[model samples]
Target: MWDACPIELARPQKCAISEDRDKLYMDFAAPLVSEDLTLVEADPFQLMVRNGNQTCTIKYTDPSNAILSKENACVFAVNLEQHVESDLILSPTRGCKVLANRNETNLFSLSHCEKHQPHEESHFVQIKPHNKQCHTYCPESNLTFEGVNGKCPNDVWVMPMNTNFKINDVQFNGSRISIVHQETLDHVGSMKANMHLQSSVNWISLMYEINRSQPDFKPLPPFELHDYTHYVSYSFCVVVITALSLIICIVGKKLNNLPQSD
Candidate 1:
């Protein structure tokens, strides 16, 4: 608990919907400081999971087993084997998420996001059988509004996880820690903090993907964001109006000062 709020994190895991909609699988690295939030050292944290009737703990560590560990840090895995015919709501009795505990807020170690989010619940619908016509349906998801069928044009789900080198040594000057890195993919998706003795340890997770489409590669949108009319200047209108006003004023002044018609 860095300020009494669970520090948020991200990991690459197989986030999927259940086949019977009764349970799901979670496999990801421990939550790292969110690139979106203000960060100070990426010190590893821990978790106390309460999932279903079973319980387990996992984490990612560096190859040498150092602070803010890596190599698949903080792994939270839950497997549910319920094959039902219809879609069912996953009750806490049937299954639950592996949440984090705040008993040791001061302890720095690698842990899961459930620690940051205490009231997070997840659910998934089991894949239904294909009809005689060989047609099936997709589990309801953000990607599918009314739920799609086996004929969904988009069938790919990718989760990218990564393990960059941890800061072995840092020069702490009061509230910030100083470290350096050369050009590499690790530099992407992270925001550098300008502080002394404080640092935002960006944790990268591996990529997990599920492709439900055909083997042949195909463009989904068939267009890029720039492909559409996408130029937006919040002040463009004002600038144009100001320029027009200046021109009009200049022209009006010239007309007023011109020799009077006789």
Candidate 2:
């Protein structure tokens, strides 16, 4: 019974306990807390219940930010002892610095409990682009750019696109530049699927249900414009001067060759 495992501070006002032959189930009424309540640096909530000599512990947790290596790849250092359902929420607002859930989307979710190296911080998950030299940048004028073959770090997202939150479209010269116009859901979905296939961790899945109304945004293109006006103008002037000089020489030679006429 839940009475045996008393909850501290906030007790369940309404609870139901059911039991089958080999298993037991319990349901309780409790106010839901916002996932954003937890700070990125802070440890997660751990609930402990004691029944005589035995104790049961349950943790409500989220994953920390994956560290960026010198190679510019994301290396997630995970404590193997942590065996709880965790969500690695990614957000463009938070950039690549923190993994806080404020305005975040669930990029990876882990539910299975498997014993791994205990107590030590091990390299648990690594997500990197196939080509480190290649970076994806949104050109200033357009919303659509080439997608990185693999996940690459952006200002906010570790991946090329956020799974849920849509970044604001660039407004240039009274026109909206948007990736939603150039890229389809199917294209992004296929990318996420391919990452899962190439992924080494089997317990995690790209499980975030993207809201159709607020579609995910591809990263904004970096502000870039190439103009050769100076070079072109200089070349044009040089050609004109050269042609005029040749015409003057030909005219002077013709005058010199012509016989003087009264």
Residue-wise C-alpha lDDT for candidate 2, range 121-150, written one tens digit per residue:
112212222221112222111232233233
For model 2, the superposed segments whose C-alpha errors exceed 4 Å read 1-227
Instruction: Please identify model 1 stretches exceeding 4 Å from their true place.
Output: 1-44, 47-60, 65-200, 203-262
Instruction: Give the per-residue lDDT digits (tens) of candidate 1, residues 67-159.
Output: 111222221112223322232212222221122233312222234323223222112111221111111212222232223322222222221
**What's the C-alpha lDDT at position 70 in model 2?**
22
- Give the distance in Å from residue 211's predicted Cα in candidate 1 to where it truly belongs: 20
| TM-score of each candidate structure, all chains considered together | 0.17, 0.15
